[model samples]
Target: MLTLFHSPGACSMGIVFLLEELGVDYTLAAIDLRKGEQNDTAFRQMNPKGKVPTLILDDGTALTEFPAIAYWLCRRHGAAELWPDTIDGQARVLELVEFLVASIHMRGFTFLAMPQKFSADPAAQDSLRALGRREVEAGLATVAAQHGAALCARSRIGIEDAALFYILVWARALGIAVPAPLSAYAEALLARPSAQVALRGLAAG
Candidate 1:
């Protein structure tokens, strides 16, 4: 069986949602980020980057990173809908996922939540946070314009939806305002049984 290493309320929850949606039996290993468990030797042996959402395959090979893990699971399970078969459709999903990782999580949330990582000076940290706020707002707008309406209209949830839902969790925690459409879309996703199951996993952790 596969084992997924995750932290509560982290972006790793996206993988949990995907696993629930796929109906795959897997073990959940909760890493307590608050206590710095992710930085420990055991965890580092599995993922040198010391990040959550690390998947240990049945053969014991470890996989890290959201985009790669999501794609791997979708393909391994033959869930084509989650990751379209066609080049163009697959590209679109990847584009959205990468944008969320790069523009939103890396450039926006990381700076906003942990500005000290970027600079030591207090003034620079404040400026970085302000910039993160702007980037987050702009990123949400882009997501709203690109995928919000389509995601809400679709009956089946996809990989991109899982990723977007996770990002919204961070947005809410940071008190960042999302676009109106995305706000509604978030409600829709949360109502799904799969999303609820994933949330329960996080809460239980």
Candidate 2:
């Protein structure tokens, strides 16, 4: 059985939603980020990156990273609706995924959430946070311009939107305003049975 290491309300929640949508059997292992369970020796043994959303396959093979996990699940389960079929559509999915995970989550949100990683100086930290806010808003605007209308009010949830959902959660936490289109998208996503199950988390087996 697949085992997913995740923290509630974190980026790993996206993977949780994907797993639910796939309707595949999987186990959930909670990692307390606040308590630093990610850095624990046992968890680190499986994933040296010490991050959430680390998927442990049946054979004990560890898969780390969001995009990789999402792709693997969709392919393994024949979830074409979540992934896409055509070359252009696949390319668009990847483009949005990379932008959302790498740019929005890694760079922008990290900056705002953990500015001390960039610099120890208090003055520099302030500037870093400000830069983070700008980066996130600008990145979100790019998303809104490119695909917001298509995704907003959409009944079918794509892989890209799963990625976008987590970012929207962070945006809300940071008190950042998201585009109207994306806001509607978030509502639709959250209302789904998959999302509802994901939010409450799955039972460990």
Question: Pick by lDDT: which candidate is best?
Answer: 1
The per-residue C-alpha lDDT of model 1 at residue 86 equals 91
- Highest TM-score: give the candidate number: 1
**TM-score of candidate 2 relative to the true fold:** 0.91
Taking the tens digit of each residue's C-alpha lDDT, what string does model 2 give over 1-205?
9999999878999998888877889999999888999999999999999999999998999999899988888788745566677999899889999999999988898898889978999999999898889999999998988888888645666677668878987787677888878777766777788877777743432
Residue-level lDDT of model 1, residues 45-163, one tens digit each, is: 98999998899999999999998988888878745566677999989989999999878998998888889987999999999999999999999999998888887788776777668
Which pairs clash (backbone N, Cα, C closer than 3 Å) in model 1? none
Provide the TM-score for each candidate, comma-separated.
Answer: 0.93, 0.91
